[model samples]
Target: MAETVFARTPRLVWRAGTPDDVEALYAIVSDFDVVRQTETWPWPADLSFTRSRCIVTASDQGASGVVCQGDEVVGYLGLSPEGKIGYMFGKFYWGRGLATEIGAAAVAYAFDRFDWQCLEACVFADNPASGRVLEKLGFEEGNACQGPCRARGGVYPIRTFRRPRA
Candidate 1:
């Protein structure tokens, strides 16, 4: 296994998450707008639940990551064993290259650590910024579909994107 590099991006550190990240993970999970557009995860997220997410992210094949700098967790990302790698940046941390930075690292991890065949993303149709992020990482867009997102407040369409493992 590649000794985790304390992987550096322009601003964030992509490292394996620990139990200590529960609180930081909760901040983003509690943000309906953040988790909703991303996954429709049941909302008004409680700290306990978010804590579990942090621990589980490391174990889940997809939809898991730790976005940190030094020691502060700024954002979180994940790549499911099933080919879904999702990401969410805190509202306070948006607009920086952090998303792309950690995202590329996560993709590298998937390829290097798991011998993953391919990874994919499902973006709510309205969220072009996310699609752009995936594009920057070399993901290609594919079939689109209407989808429901209870956490996002209602149903909406989502587009799918794919990145082949290198």
Candidate 2:
């Protein structure tokens, strides 16, 4: 199958992820700051795992979109079949409004493509920035719970958020 373009923002292109993105993605997830805010990306980045995740099997089509600025991979945005959305960006790209931009696109695409009534997302409680991104996308704060963080090798406090189809 051919790669599909999923979304576009002022500075990013969200497109189907491929194995070729492994290296760039690994670079982003390798940073402790980046992975600590995430749920499952392990610390000490492993190329093998990145490779496995980047593979665009028929099952993953439209699920994992590589966020790029021009030709460089800058981030990842994915929505699971169950309607859980997750995203991450390179450290170099931090302190910008990219997350909020792509988030709006993700919400639009997921709601339209999956026709789900709601989309779910969560952020480590310490990551107020990510929570703000969700809020900017109109996600409502929901629950507070403990969640496993593979990168941190332990559980962390998390805040859940949900966005209803609009």
Candidate 3:
């Protein structure tokens, strides 16, 4: 594996995923709304389907993190080999600037540890909070695509954003 990006924000520590983390990871990722927001898949219970997804996730992605605020795992973030980073927070932990703060650390860590020149994120148009966080973190909005972006259950505009090289 390549070097993992460990992000340290004021409120959270973002670290890579492990086999041991499946349970907690499952809890966060399986949240109905959160899953729907980030994925193009159906709502899944903790059965073989979800387990396989987790196993393959461990195999394919080099960096996965158990997001921790001290002793509690608040959320998770991932950096793909292609330089795309996906993130989500626990529903209870939202609206506290935690996402942007974690995003800042993740972005910085990606730039520093991976020598990445840029990073990209995809957000459903309905989610303004995500867009604002990306913009506040200096991600420039890109073109939008009309999509049935799996989660929304209908065709809608999908906006892309990117953080350019400094």
Best by TM-score: 2
For model 3, residues 10-110, the per-residue Cα lDDT tens digits are 77887755465567667876777776667444466354543444333322433656677986778777778878877778798889899899888878777
TM-score of 1: 0.85
Q: Which ten residues in a row have the lowest lDDT in candidate 2?
A: 53-62
Q: What lDDT tens digits, residue by residue, belong to model 2 across residues 1-166?
A: 6778888888888887787788898898889899888888888888887777776432432477689999999998888878899999998998799999988988888876776889999999999989999999999999799999998899989999999988
List, in order, the clash count of every candidate structure. Answer: 12, 0, 3
Candidate 2: pairs in clash: none
Ranking by lDDT: 2, 1, 3
In TM-score terms, candidate 2 sits at: 0.93
**Residue-by-residue lDDT tens digits, candidate 1, 1-166:** 4324435766678666677787788877788778777664667786666776676535434446578877788887777778788788887887787888888877887777676788888899988889999999999999998777767667788999999976
Indicate the residue-level lDDT of 129 in model 3: 87
The stretch of ten residues in a row with the least summed lDDT in candidate 3 is 53-62
Q: Find the number of clashing residue pairs for candidate 1.
A: 12
TM-score, prediction 3: 0.81
